[model samples]
Target: MTLPTITATRYVLPLREGGSLPGVVEGNDLGTYVIKFHGAGQGPKALVAEIIVGELFRRLGLRVPELKLIQLDPAIGKSEPDFEIQELLIRSAGLNLAVDFLPGSFGYDGSAGNPGDQAMARILWLDAFVANVDRSWRNTNLLVWHKNLWLIDHGAALYFHHSWMPAEKFATLPYDASDHVFSIATPDVPGVDAELAAAITPELLTEVIGLVPNEWLEDGDRERYLDYLTARLDKRSAWLPGGAR
Candidate 1:
């Protein structure tokens, strides 16, 4: 599926809370988005993870903001006082990853608007499947908007791709969910695993990964992701939080 592309008309403000220095921007579509720049500290790989994992989450029927390929023009940041942000905008003056901005969203406090046990189980299971290490109490990476939980900031997921090691080597690695934001109590992990794991078929993975822009992936990287995720799903017994059912 091709993600909708929009040109950024203006850079509104920087979200300094993010290590990579993402920012709010107004799009030609007249929509607001949180733009994740390619020039960020983590580079384009983080944007790749964001698209792959975010789209996968959406396919799994989870709440995630609509993602788009935003065309950024560095001239939009010319008037910005921050030299650092100006430099970043200059370097990222091309296609970048962005998500629909939630107008009144608040950081999830882990209590309000709880999505119930089953949904929480699904969320935890997904993180384990992708080997995501960012969704912890320290940085929930979750937002509560309009009384619902919305997942975000998946740039830290699929850490195995950061190296040249064989993807199969990371397939059997265990995920430690003890630090997960929703790890307070055990959810019906096996039940959720049974339901969700079947949904991650190779076809679905291909579609999800296809949503990533071609420039984001290098040669063979596409097949490598497919193979890694497929293998990981097959070897879930080693990584599922509560062990396979």
Candidate 2:
């Protein structure tokens, strides 16, 4: 099923910590969301990565906040005094990506206790699968809500897609797992890889890609993205910990 799109009703506050200048927006659906703007320095590619990778995690049975397409109205930026934010809001006065806001959520200090072996392994494996380079110790990009770990800030994943090289060229690239904030030790990498391999089928990948809006696609970019992901999924052994076996 596809996610619902909602119009932002109110801009509550800016999340200064995020590099993209995401803001807390109240949607017409009576939901609070953390929105990522299309005009951010990272560009629309970041939003695409967020939707694809985040949905992939959800399909894998992992914990991630619900995502939505947020429609931003420029009038909301007129009241803002910050020139930078006002300009960004004006530029991004269109469709953007938002994640459901979890109240009382706190940054993961790596002290709320471990996520266990299976969970950690699956997370690491997914990171490797997508070549996410931002999950280091310095910025976990993870949140704690209701005593469970929730993944967030996935715009940095899928870096390989940004390059001009043919997708197959980077499909075999190696991913360094040492910097992962959560320890990868003792996790069943091979098992998780096998499970995900079976679960992330062709139809599922297409569905995840379909979540992205057409306006975000430039020329053949969407088809290229789908081709790259499908190719990587078929040749996952090169990037995955264990061979695709």
Candidate 3:
């Protein structure tokens, strides 16, 4: 399950809506992508989180855009008019993360209607398990493309790795889903957990983690990620929405 690597051929535009300042890029494969720079404010760890969480979401049978490893050349953005953007490109030379650009897609709002109980529950369950705090109603981090829901911007998930804290410590941390975009939908998180937990085996996690680039991880970080996620999965009783029985 390796991600195909593509070279950034041109810098199309900057997406300033995000704090990280990702941009639209044309890839050597002739495809357009939303490129997340390794040099963004969040740094490479954000790209690592993006790959791991996004891939995990896809494996769980949810909708997410295709991900790729984008090889960037700082010179590509030399002609850019924005100094900040140009400097960002210079810093991001080498490798970066990118997603297939979905045209005609719009941010998810309540106007299109709810995604239903089961689907909503699944999304909520996944976010909780990964400790994703970015899917709040204010940000949503979801997209509507051709009337289908697509998850995006998982770089904010798996935040426990930012420090040296024991991964097990975060295993039981309660997720505040009250502000989740689907909070009003009343998802049956426990029921969804029962249906999905078994699918998150260590083997599946290993495969998903393998998708991340080695350059993006520091010494022992790979093992750390595996350990943390494994512990999180095993200790679901402590954080699986409903109080532990």
Best-performing candidate as measured by lDDT: 1
Residue-wise C-alpha lDDT for candidate 3, range 1-245, written one tens digit per residue: 78999999999999988699999999999999999999989899988889899999999999999999999987886888899999999999999998999999999987887888888878988898999999987899999999999999998999998884787698887788788887753447777776688889889888988988888888888788889998988888877764433
The clash count of every prediction, one per candidate, is: 0, 0, 0
List clashing residue pairs in candidate 3: none
In model 1, the clashing pairs are none
lDDT of 1 by residue, 1-245 (tens): 59999999989999998679999999999999999999898888998899899999999899999999999887887777899999899999899998999999998986785678888888999998998999988899999999989999999999888894576677889989899987743457888887898899999999988888888789988898999999999888988888777
Task: Name the regions of candidate 2 deviating beyond 4 angstroms.
Answer: 242-245
> Model 3 — TM-score against the truth?
0.97
Which is the winner by lDDT between candidate 1 and candidate 2?
Answer: 1
Please give the TM-score that candidate 2 achieves against the real structure.
0.94
Candidate 1 off by > 4 Å: 185-187
How far residue 35's Cα lies from its native spot in candidate 1, in Å, is 0.4
